[model samples]
Target: MSASPRARRMTGAQAGAVTARILSAAVGGYALAYAATAFLSVYLPMERPDRVSFASLASFFVWVATILYVFAARSAWRATWVPLALSLLLGLAAFLPGGYGVRP
Candidate 1:
């Protein structure tokens, strides 16, 4: 069955929201993966190989969760911003001076 006319025609605002949601999911997934891996690498009291293995496994779930959360949020705007804010915060926490891998 074909889609209804209403379903086929998307407004500019609706299109923009869809695009935002997609971009948010992609970027949020990447950011979440990176941040989670970095965090596990630094904080997990395990050997380097073990830490890397654990981080890699955890990052997959992080990416999946980010995508689900972004799509499930009531407001697309919030869906975009919340993950971005979390990405920024976690990224900064993982990489800042005196953080995980700093050599100072």
Candidate 2:
């Protein structure tokens, strides 16, 4: 269903907020998962330190920054080019590299 007439018009600012919210949720989930993985790598006994997933913690930090995107998306936040770009770059850096993956 289309939006109501009253809701028909959405300014760029308003749209940005909604986008931010969605991004926030997605990034937050990523961060949590990364953190959990990183936690196990650090405290858990590891026979080989070389097997540690070094990138996982860095990925967590990048994902955490997505909160700004989420905030902008959910609450009609203005569309800022810099934050969006940063988020994308960070996401790629964190997700594209296999530096964070560890397998049994």
Candidate 3:
């Protein structure tokens, strides 16, 4: 079936595949940062990542990618949806300046 504009742009199966890609990418990115932090922590704790630019940016991208990929899989990916919803709620609050949090 064709995807509805209001409905996600991907089919359920496609969504699942996309989620896998997103997860893999996220894991790879995190591992890279983790290794960087591990090596750098020895010389500088603050520079390790919690407040650094690249760390925060990577985290933000990971979050966005996860959300998009997960939500796209909502049709057949019931198992992956709960976390997506929670993330959406938190994202709503965090973004949009002072916008209200998402309601269930």
Candidate 4:
């Protein structure tokens, strides 16, 4: 039988990787989800209320998927950087060129 979690010892690298996955799933995933929601809200061609609702709904899935990806990634570094990069890209897409600040 396999050892219990408390009985099993993790190496420093294993612990660090787990920590990175957790942080990436929480913080990075939220950032990515927020960015995706913003981008979708701006670009989805629905009416305002419908667009917002759809984007909000989609963001939940995005967050869950990010969490899964973070844990499933081959390396902690990949998990960390991929979501961060995607969030930045999505944020830029959402905020740039649309003059989003001046909406009446």
Candidate 5:
């Protein structure tokens, strides 16, 4: 026999977890992509066009990896905090004075 509707439906916590995972995938993934591209473009020792192209490709991979990591994490807290921390670190590295492009 088929289960009742209530039995098949997700509980409140399950729904919240799903929502958190989706938001993490969207926002966290974008943050990771942007930070990675910015850092790579500045740090890589390549011509401008080549560096940009490489950074763009690398950002795509970073974004995908972020999404996968968010879903695979055991808890939503880790999924959110880890990427947030990494993005902040990368942002600091890219924007700090004498960090990337500053010349003596």
Candidate 6:
């Protein structure tokens, strides 16, 4: 069966939005996961090995959640910026001088 032209077609802006969403889901998700893992590993009160292992495991969930958020967002720009902002915040917290594991 043939679908209507309008139903079957994507405009250029729609394509671009989809592409942006996919890129954000893949790249932004990974970056967010990395930042979350780092932050968790540094801040979790558990022993070093336990914290590392738990953080690594939790990162998988974080990545999956980020991907979902990117797709569910109202716009591609929102998808991109929210994850980027979160990644930066987490990365900063993980690496900042006053954060745990930082030396004097």
The estimated TM-scores of all candidates read 0.81, 0.34, 0.28, 0.87, 0.85, 0.88
TM-score of candidate 1 to 2 decimals: 0.81
lDDT string, candidate 4, 30-55, tens digits: 99999999999988888989999999
Off by over 4 Å in 5: 1-7, 98-104
How many clashing residue pairs appear in each of the predictions shown?
0, 9, 0, 0, 0, 0
Prediction 3 TM-score vs. true: 0.28
Task: Give candidate 4 misplaced runs (Cα > 4 Å).
Answer: 1-7, 100-104
lDDT (tens digit, per residue) of candidate 5 on 1-104: 99876787779999989888889889998998999998887788999888889999999899999999999999988888888889989877776845555722
Write down the worst ten-residue block by lDDT for model 6. Answer: 95-104
In TM-score terms, candidate 5 sits at 0.85
Q: RMSD, model 6, all Cα superposed?
A: 2.6
For candidate 3, give the lDDT of residue 17. Answer: 67
Candidates 2 and 6 compared: the better one by TM-score is 6
Q: What is the lDDT of candidate 5?
A: 0.87
- lDDT accuracy of residue 44 in candidate 2: 44
Alpha-carbon lDDT, every model: 0.83, 0.51, 0.48, 0.94, 0.87, 0.93
Least accurate 10 contiguous residues by lDDT in model 1: 95-104
> What is candidate 3's lDDT per residue for 1-104, written digit by digit as tens?
97667885668878766666566446533443344433233333454455355544555555555555554554434425444454455444344333444421
Clashing pairs in 1: none
Worst 10 residues of 5 by lDDT: 95-104
> For model 6, how does the per-residue alpha-carbon lDDT over 1-95 read when each residue is reduced to its tens digit?
98876786779999999999999999999999999999998889899999999999999999999999999999999999999999999999888
- Cα RMSDs of all predictions? 3.1, 8.6, 13.1, 3.7, 2.8, 2.6
lDDT of 1 by residue, 1-89 (tens): 99876776879998998898999999877887888888777667888889889998999999999999988988889989888788787
lDDT of 4: 0.94
Considering lDDT, which of the candidate structures 2 and 3 is the better prediction for this target?
2
Which of 3 and 6 is the better model by TM-score? 6
